[model samples]
Target chain A: MATAATSDIKWWAGGRSPFNMEYGKLMMWYFLMSDAFTFGAFLISYGTIRFSQNYWPDPNHVFNAFPFAGHANLPLAFVSLMTFILIISSVTMVLAVHAGHHMDRKGVIKWMIWTIVGGIAFLSCQAWEWTHLITGHHPVLIDGVVQEIGTTVSRNPWGPDVTGMMHDGMQVTKTGPVAFGGYFFGITGFHGFHVLSGVVINIIMLIMTLNGTFDRRGHYQMIEKAGLYWHFVDLVWVFVFLCFYLI
Target chain B: MQHSSNTHSPEVTFHHAPGDSASTIKKIVRTTVILSVITLIELALGFGIYMLHKNPDPSHALILFIKGVIVILSLLKAFYIVGVFMHLGDEVKNMIMTIVVPLMLFIWFIAAFLWDGNAWRNLRNTDAGHRPAKQEQVTKPVDAKKPGGIE
Candidate 1:
């Protein structure tokens, strides 16, 4: 009868009542849902600002990096690599969870380490990309002339003297308060901050797992919880890629 | 809950479990090949639009059509991941829907905002020089050599 019930009990039916899972998985899912909303709000705000602006620069033009050759239209590559890394990490995570089911501590640890490494590599690449963008590697076309976009008014769409650089790396001089640079920094910076946070969380999990915390608990729920967060991170990146890179 | 050693029921079996290796590697490879072909088609269409369309400003209608295709492709991929890899395919309907439906809404909300916003920007580009309600007398003629509505 119990075996029959096991096969028959629907997940949502069980969702109503507490089952074998601890509060950890539920709380993790709740946290992921909240994080999803945060990313959604950011994307919506990005759309609003991009729409309001008259002349948005092409994403392809702004993000071009030729792999090992020269900086050239390869914005998609870093993001795509990030996507693959996250997906591969998630696969490893699932394998960890499977190992947990069998009580294979060593197997779980091996996979968890791999996932953590992928997360760190992804964060590093994102940091490099963010620095390049902030430094103005790609200049915008102003008034039909291409010029350096940083604090120097080498050239711009609004004609000469429209923009200038400030002493600090933070401030950029442009035609008005709502120049393109402001919007670009605001959107990309917000997403980059999320990646940084995700990296920190992954590191924390890695340290805990290494210390045999998860092994002692005898519950793979932590692995599943980490998977949920990791998957959410990857999902947000997909949208970020589309909105910031392809769009 | 009994913690049975028997594999008779296989309580929490993974689709890609490592070695009795229930799923063949060939199956995973086949799925990849099929998905890659679809992605190639999308790439071809994207390049075709960029090359053939003389009008840089795609009308709202065209944007909407392209947006529809993008959403469909994305949904298909999402479902494949959830079903095949997540092993939610053979699960109950409510569970499957629970995983899939919210994603659809999420994609729709973001795409709608992006499409509507880009349309407004393109329209503004047509009247780039004139402020909507600000009336300023033109003491000097507008610069003819400068491209006014260029983006």
Candidate 2:
């Protein structure tokens, strides 16, 4: 009694996907893949410029300052702490997703709250680092005149003097090259913006969870999507840390 | 006790309770701990090398080796995050390929651009790439007669 059309229909032509993934989740992965390219380009550019220069800033000397350390040389200590915090936050985010799958609303909320806290903490550390860098002075001697310098789009306290010139009695003092600051600010600023956006998205997800939105739907796929974004941000940081801090 | 006929309908269904087994939770904790430990080791190695070298100029091979280790550690961390945390490991093979193949192109793009950028850097300092321009001094004379009789 079955119709020929119904009996002969192909699985590929059906509404269900053979890949066993929802359309939204697959799209999220694709988007993250593209975003990874953007980060990759920025990092590759950094590597190119760094190798091209005669001297690049030593990350150890540049990032030595630590909170309340009174200028003690604890090279890369602060940034390492920041990295740990971000990694822990990534752990919490994954835990939240796991909880979501189990339909444990309370567990999801708890872990998500921890992840948001970690994001804010990381941002705060970055703000402090930037403020310290901007406000600190670097003394440079040009033409027998002592001039103080700070970070700018074209110059960085971390790099050799880019604007120094020789004269009849001119003296030159250099900190770091101009390209270092340009690339540092450009790359880190871009990453910071991503973290900010991630935080905002997490906040929205938190509010929705509180309102029982996902509970009503009897699923928490939304948490999984947000976790994907949060994890991507963390993933980018791994590369950033290697390029900017370790290398 | 007597059961109602409606309660015995074949269409009746119940939702499965949501949660993970204890072993899964343990596995998540183990992964997190491993990641943290790796990060710690990286920090120690980085700082230790810097401290031990002391000189601004260290041997090129040593520096290159250290950098290689750092990059390897970073890639490992990235792998763990993407594989387990992102649940890509659990997805079907085709779905995984759908994401991984395009990412291979991303890596190629970085490699290609970096090689080209290095070539540009070398060319930038050459005579054919750079030409100096003449300029006039624009500073005002300090000995102008009207300036308080030259102070």
Fraction of the true interface contacts (Cα pairs closer than 8 Å across chains) found in each model: 0.18, 0.50
Clashing pairs in 1: A66-A72, A142-A156, A142-A157, A143-A157, A151-A165
lDDT of candidate 1 over A1-247, digit per residue (tens): 2334555555444443222234565456456556667777776876776676755555554455533645454544555566567666656666665666566678778877887787777777777765665565324344545445542223222222234542334223233223445545555566667656766776676677778886666555566566666656655655665566544
State interface RMSD in Å for all models: 6.3, 9.1
Q: How many backbone clashes does every candidate have?
A: 5, 6
Cα deviation of B11, candidate 2, in Å: 22
- For model 2 chain B, where is the 10-residue window of minimal lDDT? B1-10
- Runs off by more than 4 Å, candidate 2: A1-11, A160-172, B1-19, B124-151
Best-fitting candidate, measured by TM-score? 2
Query: Candidate 1, what DockQ?
Result: 0.14
Q: Across residues A12-66, which tens digit of lDDT does each residue of candidate 2 receive?
A: 5656555645667778899999899888888888887776666777788778899
Q: Candidate 1, which segments miss by more than 4 Å at Cα?
A: A1-3, A6-21, A73-75, A137-147, A151-188, B4-21, B24-67, B80-151
lDDT of 1: 0.55
TM-score of predicted structure 1: 0.66
